[model samples]
Target: MSTSDDDYYSDGIDIRDLPKVSLHDHLDGGLRPQTIIELGEQIGLDLPATEAEDLADWFVDSCSAGNLPDYLKTFDLSIAVMQSEQGLRRVAREFVEDLVDDGVVYGEIRWAPEQHLQGGLSLDQTVVAVQAGIDEAIDDAVRDGRDIRIGQLVTAMRHADRGLEIAELAVRHRDRGVVGFDIAGAEAGFPPSRQRAAFDYLASEYFPVTVHAGEADGLDSIRGALFDGRALRLGHGVRIAEDITIERSDDENVYVSLGRLAQWVKDREIVLELSPSSNLQTGAIERWGDEMDDHPFDLLYQLGFRVTVNVDNRTMSATTLTRELGLLGDAFGYDLRDLESFQLNAAASAFLPLEEREELSERISAGFEAADNEGA
Candidate 1:
């Protein structure tokens, strides 16, 4: 069955109302269909569909190409409209609003600014524009009685040589809305090592880094993200499960052994931003199977990896954090407690100060308790 933006529940609890943290959400991939239609018209760019509903359908259908290259092609249309400051601002504002509706109390929106300079906007100008939109949306949400916080993760494309420039841009705006740095894009040939200079600069600045590894690549890519990029987190590190071997299994339990790489990741508790539907759509989990149940998310989580659920691209996957959690719960028979654990994992992994992370944990605990009490 197709996933929709409708409400999702497990055991009479509405998942949408639960407080959550989003760590791997993409700024360009979550554009509203109606906004895309209007923006395309203004830019005179030919879109796959003109109507909002039709456009939304087209994105989902087109993105289900079962490979990273094909899945990334959908971004061309979205990035085309996001070339101008106005376009970036509108999309960022709407992205925050949508997150508020999805019960996200905190989120980090990641995007590559170098790709959005087609309309003559500078790299810093694009960042400022997106920040303006985020600030405006936060204020608007506050006026409407919703309190949400957001941070920007300025990403550098792995296939480009602009990593150092993008890294500088992110650090320049560190005091602004930008929170951290990331390297995303085609991961196979373009390893994080390609951007070693940027990573070194970021490391020297004591900045946080999350690399897009183990999604389209395997163990070596993940290793580079950690050792070379010094990535604190692995974006969609689902393929890390490849390093784990199930030595034996019985009716009641399963025995497993982890390779050195997986062992270090698990022992260090590096966050794995696991996006289930996106993984399935991009064939990231095709080594296991073609279904969501085949995802290594459960394996990583069960083995004590710092696995946090995310909606990598809401529009492309037609999903939300709530829907992703709901799907995982259904596939793996998760209950409220299991769901709460995911939120806690995300809260702890968020790129925030120690005190702030603790506060987030408290809020999540209280929210889950309230939900439990209400259900009782």
Candidate 2:
């Protein structure tokens, strides 16, 4: 049940081969170290580490800080190298390729286009370059006999004042590659209500939204994301566990109750895009515990919350979907069925059309069924 460099298996099934849907992956956070070095050199950008392995180590080390702000500081390097059209294109193409290797059949890569415009590229231009890269990667995967699909989730930094602009940009490119809109970045002081204009616009346009809440803040922030931003999914909504109270404990059963917010989230089936390693790295679950076993993911799952596993930042966490699932299995003694349920939850929560989502669910079920048969 432990994941090593060579193996990521759970319940006698190779986790690497299981189909996954990545709902909270970040574009600027998942770059390959070598790609950063090469892109940094071309852009005359000074890097913390010139060597790939050393750079990778630096990212992991810098992001291990048990606070959300400190953990996010490592992104300056990754985002610095992603300013130009070429950098954006290459990073995006490789992002999808890496997802394929991690067994992600469907991934919604989220990034702030406003941050990538420092190189004089317009918001639309940056989106176009990224979509071009995604198209190329999908074609390459098809040629290699691997069926993979990707969608872009355009994000607006919550601290910034460009929410309306970013929301418009996402909708503008909806036909190209953008499938949804999101608000990320520092989620403590800036609630989704601050960007009411943007959310209202997205709502008018009937666009899907996922907001970063319950990670760096508490229930109030999540309430704003739900009511103000009208978010359909919550990014790292791990802190919602704060609203759950354990009433009593017995040898046989532990009685618990959910607050109004938690009850609403559970009743509405709002997808919680839970990133296990990222939650730990950012201190999102510190109130519960400091280790993986302390994560509220199991509590939420057992309570019928629609929970899904994700690698928020592949480079920063030095993790893959396979590795995240393995860690959860190790922590919770989960079997193949538990892992399959996570995938099904994610597939059902994807931003695609209902028909496409159903197709994705079928693909995931078929893949897990094959693995189960092999294990049997």
Q: Which of the numbered candidates is closest to the native, going by highest TM-score?
A: 2
- The local distance difference test score of model 2 is 0.94
Per-residue lDDT over 35-75 for candidate 1, one digit per residue giving the tens place of the 0 to 100 score: 99999999798987888889999999998989999999999
TM-score of 1: 0.98
Whole-model lDDT per candidate: 0.93, 0.94
Q: Kindly report which residue pairs in candidate 2 clash with one another.
A: none
Find the candidate with the highest lDDT and give its number: 2
Candidates in order, TM-scores: namely 0.98, 0.99
Each prediction's Cα RMSD? 1.5, 0.9
Give candidate 1's whole-model lDDT.
0.93
